[model samples]
Target: MRSLPLTPSRPVTAASDGRPALPPQHLADLDLGQRQTLLAGLGQPAYRAKQISTHYFGRLTRDPQAMTDLPAAVRAGVAERLLPTLLTPVREDACDSGATRKALWRLHDGALVESVLMGYPDRVTVCVSSQAGCGMACPFCATGQAGLTRNLSTAEIIDQVVHLAGVAAAGGVTGSPPRLSHVVFMGMGEPLANYGRVIAAVRRLCAPPPEGLGLSQRHVTVSTVGLVPAMRRLAGEDLSVTLALSLHAPDDDLRDELVPVNQRWKVAEVLDAAWEYADRTGRRVSIEYAMIRDVNDQPWRADLLGRLLAGRMAHVNLIPLNPTPGSRWDASPKPIEREFVRRLRTAGVAVTVRDTRGREIDGACGQLVAAETAS
Candidate 1:
């Protein structure tokens, strides 16, 4: 995998916005009437909030020049204050013939986060980072290995999708979808760890146009490594986002080794929380298993996993472990992977292998940022 610059850097301080960054309160960050209050404080009428919202979310334009509905006098002030930029593009690399593209962004505080946009025949999905880096120290995960930099603000998380939606609108993807239809929080950070901001960002993303992106709540997926309390808390949001449990293994012995959080919550506790969420939201949970060779891929572990998930309102997404540089972990062999799937199916669990995208572009979560930091 090689690095490609998406745009030229303007100027950045050592803190990386290259300039004094404003406090994080972009228009995207606010709730419904909050923008009106912001504009009213600026001595502008309340209706200006709707105009700014329409410009950002409806037309997907960040340029003041493109916001013709607003007076020229207030455009700069409105953009500078209400819609200040949160993420600066460092670079982006595309793979899968431009269908799978990964972007590395530099946050105002110099924390780097990554997002991946994958175009399919039916839908366009963008995997966004909820935090700059990850705190969950999963040994096999590159982001986890790096440790946490900072939790991304609601605007920061929202920025990833808004920017990519503009890209898609410009026909940046191979299949040529002009709008984002699905989003997944399977990027750099443990989403539940940054609970409040992540939840706010979810609301902002699912809110109808002129308020948020207006995507279906069902199309959104938030992944976690089984933060038990947070999982239970999320079920109460009535957001209806599909909860994906990053359950790399079944038994506590192996899981505690693979997913460090399992040491605290244990495998059973996590699964129970996931089932409770499914019951509450009427949404099927997604179990994420990264098959690693000779580690958690043993036949007995597969059987144990199947037994744990058997007859649950869930589907197992078998991820062929994307090998990280200098890491001992690697994807399971084809025969072994198939056997793992077979065991789950025999146990009456629905299963499918994840499409391994952006391999050539460091598409795996945190791979691109890790490479950047190392350099």
Candidate 2:
């Protein structure tokens, strides 16, 4: 196993053209126009772009041999240039009777990232990473501890969804629908930090087939650790994806410690941006709070959180903290969690505890990658 630098040696910057250089350009990385132009340069007609897109986005198969409609002579070269392998699976773990599975992947540069596919009775959702590790530095998060590696390219992010979608379609997940219908950017990194690529990936995910994946935009969710500017920018993108604000703490003092980004954006500013997103998109913002044992689960804090979100276009998702290895943090006790929920409900805030999945398998975002790299 190759080890990756947990923290970037230098400050991370987006490529001048907003694409990462390490992973070779992929068809998913390009828009339809660029795809057409590339094929033209290869002496293939422009329509080959759409033909290839149908195989990838519509059929969810990237094997050149499976694209039988294309001329055999051109298949391998086209696949090499446009659908270069990006995520090589390192390890996969499953729990909840195989309904929830997590996969660790190695990028071209040896940086490790993870994505999770969860199957429910009615729908399937895949949580994907936007960056290899995270820069947020949230004390209780495994990914945050790993620190920033680099932003995943647009295709790197999208491929996770496409791959997982194929798994779901093939009935890899037990007792769940055979199709993937939802996506969440709540995996290994602070999604908004890798702003451009994440947004581009969302666009590709939602665009109709032959151009992109054709998933409904409303079914996708993008999470942020309160990057105020990026949150606000996402609102104007004409997208309606759910905005999940990982507001682990309601008060500034605790939040500054729990979510280090709070020190820069502050709780008030972050909530304001979330509200702005809700207003513009007409989609209720999801306020995500991790219930840590005696950390941010007190009744007072719940009430405070309720006060902030009450009567607003928001819903609180209380996540039971999935303690990382050697981390002091632990999930709030059931009684404490119940009390917290009661307070929020009393304050007229709609709230639900997120179903804890894949816990036995180090299901938290960065744990599997961390373990793989360590081994």
Candidate 3:
């Protein structure tokens, strides 16, 4: 495993924005029954809670007026308590026949982050951000290059879903409400760094409607660049959400360069943690390998990756490096990508190339955040 050079000082501080770090809190942020009790305390009947919930979770409606069944007076308070606005859309860019949209959001603190809403024929998946930027400096990532601003609160993370779910429900191009069937923590930040909030948000996402958004836990996938201790911690949390390890390279040497955190937790250690989680949860771990041209996309590396993942209950998702503007890295050539997948399959390892999404809109994972920062 490669070692990350330790930096001596923190260049950024909470005071950079001149505001106290506001803890994240939102209506969906509450436990379902707690939300009901809060509404009940406001003089609404107990059943009205369900009605209001249907508007938000079931219908994906945030507009109070659209909740026609509720009394007018109750709408304002309900919106205030349960639907407090979390993210203001700073800019939205769409492509792929309007099926893919990348939204740059401004958080309450003026921190910028992004989420991608991609609509496919079978499923509509939202790739959401967990932190404003990333703390784990992987060097190649645009967000990592900028360094982390702060961890996103649970509500701020969930707001991305609520907003995108609303967008999908509106059906911009897909005649019917696009079913938001999948979610990926592959957006602007490293989720595990914002450990507490990310875990809470997962529960909120999976909880049945009115209590939470009612998305199935299995549909959610959280990715990390091998934070071993955190992975172990997540294993014990009883969450069955899919764990995705950004194992960019097979061994520590290349991994250290690709994912700097590998210096702290080597490849073997990270895989052990992932295997343990798989054994415990009966969920297959997703190993995300971004194939960078001539860098880590070698055929031998592909063979090694297949061998490492061979018998474990795991799947390899090969992503062609979505090269960001001015970034030195580039995607592996098509022939190389095909051969890489072929080698993994030869080793009897399950693998698939990730369908490149949102390319026209600076879709490389952290590009939108970098753009926001530049603007």
RMSD of each: 2.5, 4.7, 6.8
lDDT by residue for model 1 over 150-252, one digit each (tens)? 7888888888998898888888889856778999999999999999999998899889979999989999999999999999999998889999999998888
- Candidate 1: 10-residue stretch with minimal lDDT: 8-17
Q: Which run of 10 residues does model 2 get worst, by summed lDDT?
A: 1-10
Global fold similarity of model 2 (TM-score) = 0.94
Candidate 1 residue pairs in clash (backbone atoms < 3 Å): 12-18, 13-18
* Model 1 CA deviation exceeding 4 Å by range: 1-23
TM-score of each: 0.95, 0.94, 0.90
lDDT of 3 by residue, 279-331 (tens): 99999999998989999989899899988999999999998888889888999
lDDT of 3 at 159: 76
lDDT of 2 by residue, 208-300 (tens): 998998889999999999999999999999999999999999899999999998999999999999999999989999999999998898889
Residue 287 shift from truth in candidate 1, angstroms: 0.2
Q: What's the CA error at residue 37 for candidate 2, in Å?
A: 0.9
- Looking at model 1, residue 156 earns an lDDT score of 87
lDDT of 3 at 163: 79
lDDT of 3 at 124: 84
Ordered by TM-score, highest first, the candidates read 1, 2, 3
User: In candidate 2, residue 358 scores what lDDT?
Assistant: 84
lDDT score at residue 336, model 1, on the 0-100 scale: 99
Among the numbered candidates, top TM-score falls to 1
